[model samples]
Target chain A: MYLRGVKELSLTRSEEDHIKAIHTLTRRDGRAATNAISERLSTKASSVTDMLKKLAEKRLLKHEPYYGAKLTLKGEAVALQLVRRHRLWETFLVDRLGFGWDEVHEVAEQMEHVASEKLVDKLEAYLGHPHFDPHGDPIPDKHGRIRQRKTKSLDSCGPGESVRIVAVSETTDGLLRLLDSKGLRIGTTLVVQEVHAFDGSMDVKPKSGSAFSLSKDVSDHLQVEPS
Target chain B: MYLRGVKELSLTRSEEDHIKAIHTLTRRDGRAATNAISERLSTKASSVTDMLKKLAEKRLLKHEPYYGAKLTLKGEAVALQLVRRHRLWETFLVDRLGFGWDEVHEVAEQMEHVASEKLVDKLEAYLGHPHFDPHGDPIPDKHGRIRQRKTKSLDSCGPGESVRIVAVSETTDGLLRLLDSKGLRIGTTLVVQEVHAFDGSMDVKPKSGSAFSLSKDVSDHLQVEPS
Candidate 1:
């Protein structure tokens, strides 16, 4: 992977957003389609195509028409920096500023674009270098090193098993608020009472809170490790 | 005065910089000249004129070709918000993140554009509602109420009078570094030993440090309260 100095990492807000969208899409589909990127950014496909070409010229990504795009090594490094900034700011917002997990994403989105290496370093030190954000997503370190965790979807656990929520994949504010209302969060332990094969929903009892039935959709979003 | 919601305060980076320049110049000269604003921003006079007209059309400023530009009430409010954000971020950098006073300005300049009112308010609370920034400039509150201080330039103090540093007006890094080298900073107390009529220079003795001489240019930048 290529590494770049902070000075060389200057990008407009739109460029950074496109790079991040491509990174996220690549993680899910192994390649990022122009249409998918456009959809992600709520922009037009033609505009996405134009941006893809510009990124290609800048050596951030490689794009082929009617096919897909992929972040180059240099591109991945930049994208990781953005991710690191985003998660670090989110951690600071929630841990230091008392913002709820659901409320930090938008503010962090703006903070991520500040892009000062020393500022980020100082902020990381100020926040005690948290390894994971409030949403349970691993925060990439300064060197783009992400802490790995062994976890599976809560929906995948069988009946009578105990697990601790490690991360939640679909991090919509609505989903996060729902989980909060249900007293489910990162590190919350649950004992599965039963999993209905027909509906794929499950009845789980939190170690402290009473049992609650969660739909397949909600359970699928939750990731857990054996307790 | 026209009060605006946070959403209506949207301004491009360049626009914000221009507004800030106008506000600063107005404070110093009572009117912001296009040439002065151009020089401050390092842009062309024609470009500054175009921007002035745009701002006038937006009701942020009133521009008279030869006279100068003046901010409307709406413009002053926006400028105050920008100042509030800048000082608040500078305070956060120095008071919370351990950044040196000389190094926080550029980062704060970028951060002031984030334009998230809630984020700013939370940050104010997190920083314990500091009334003055690290440089000793008053930080405006949410309603743009600025803390007032009685002060005079160090150069203006008579011989035999002692004063405590309250603020440094021309906040260039070179000047700050020079002040740092001389053990001069906010709250440093100095007694004027002599004032040379020849070149506006003076000899002074700090309360603790050895006596020293300062040029008029250097002394003029220092604001001090009678001690």
Candidate 2:
């Protein structure tokens, strides 16, 4: 069965990038501003505007000149497909190819553009249908349905609270490398030893390791769920 | 050690396609004519000329307007890399993903453009450094060295000769499906039972299956080595 929500449409690589960028930006904000898209794509604002107009003309999104762009349902499907392909390739690189998590994002970025539904389906099966990527981000299913979890940032936990890292909200290479060095990963359980209110830093003890202090920047990006 | 002969060069998809087409054409003919490349890429001869000029300026190839295009050493390296990637991906699709041999070429064509040297290296290692692809064609080594085999066509064999399928020189989907339906595959042993010289039809008995008649067209593309 074809599980994709919408029929696969042949889109230019640039168009797919804009759709994904809009999807990511619109998730946090209701609409994606041209400036935000330009920054995300590292393209000029004028180019983003032209692309937005084109995407709007294609009925993939709604664009307001001064406001922003929001995805249509059709556009969201395409975005989800890209996300699925990206996350799957990331999982393959890290889990199967033995690549370090920090080094997989760039390669996966290039691989996600291989536009074959059948290839993705076979890969999903080969990977045993992983629910989450290496970074703990939920992978959208074939129908664009993402598994939802209710989790808060690690910084929100109080002293004595126990939690398990579910996902990292920020996945910059620096952040990933920092977490790797700290022996932190998805599913790592920790007990909040102390919360430094002054700087929003926290001392957290891993289930197996000694307590370590995490700066506000690091702790803020760590999504956790009560253990 | 880096297995690739030349440092990876960033190439546009179209540039990669042209380079690959020239490589394939030049294999049969000393030089790749504009019309041949145009036909291979399904583009206009004028467009092909324009691209050849651009590629020549990039020093990837030498373009003689009337004599057709010939790859420089750098261009051949690029072409071999593309071939390596394509064959490796095709092997992955068939050996790991369970895709039919007849159905993997198109998908591999799309995947071959993922321009990450690390990814390809890891993939080659993951596949245990496969020497040949699913179609029994030699997969170029990381250093762009293809394993050479001395083999003749099945049609060249006379009655009483024992042979084994080494590679299918023609990998068209139709041809592969025909081979598949006939229980023929790489490494399958066969004994020539009779030859009908009038139309070059030959009856051959598989080591395991019943004897079958193969037309000259089919046998011509089957590369075989004496058992």
Name model 2 segments beyond 4 Å from true: A1-5, B1-5
- Show where candidate 1 strays beyond 4 Å: B1-7
Worst 10 residues of 2 chain A by lDDT: A1-10
Pairs in steric clash, model 1:
none
Best by lDDT: 2
Q: TM-score of model 1 relative to the true fold?
A: 0.97
Expressed as tens digits, the lDDT of each residue in A61-166 for candidate 2 is 9998999998888888899999999999999999999999899888888788888888999999999999999988989988888988899999889999999999
User: How do the predictions measure up, each by TM-score?
Assistant: 0.97, 0.96
Instruction: Supply the TM-score for candidate 2.
Output: 0.96
Best by TM-score: 1
Q: Give me the displacement of residue B166 in model 2, in angstroms.
A: 1.6
For residues B1-227, what per-residue lDDT tens digits would candidate 2 score against the true structure? Answer: 13344665788999999999999988867779999999989999999999999999988899887999998888888999999999999999999999998999999999999888888888999999999898888888878899888999998999999999989986888999999999999999999999997999999999997998999999999999989
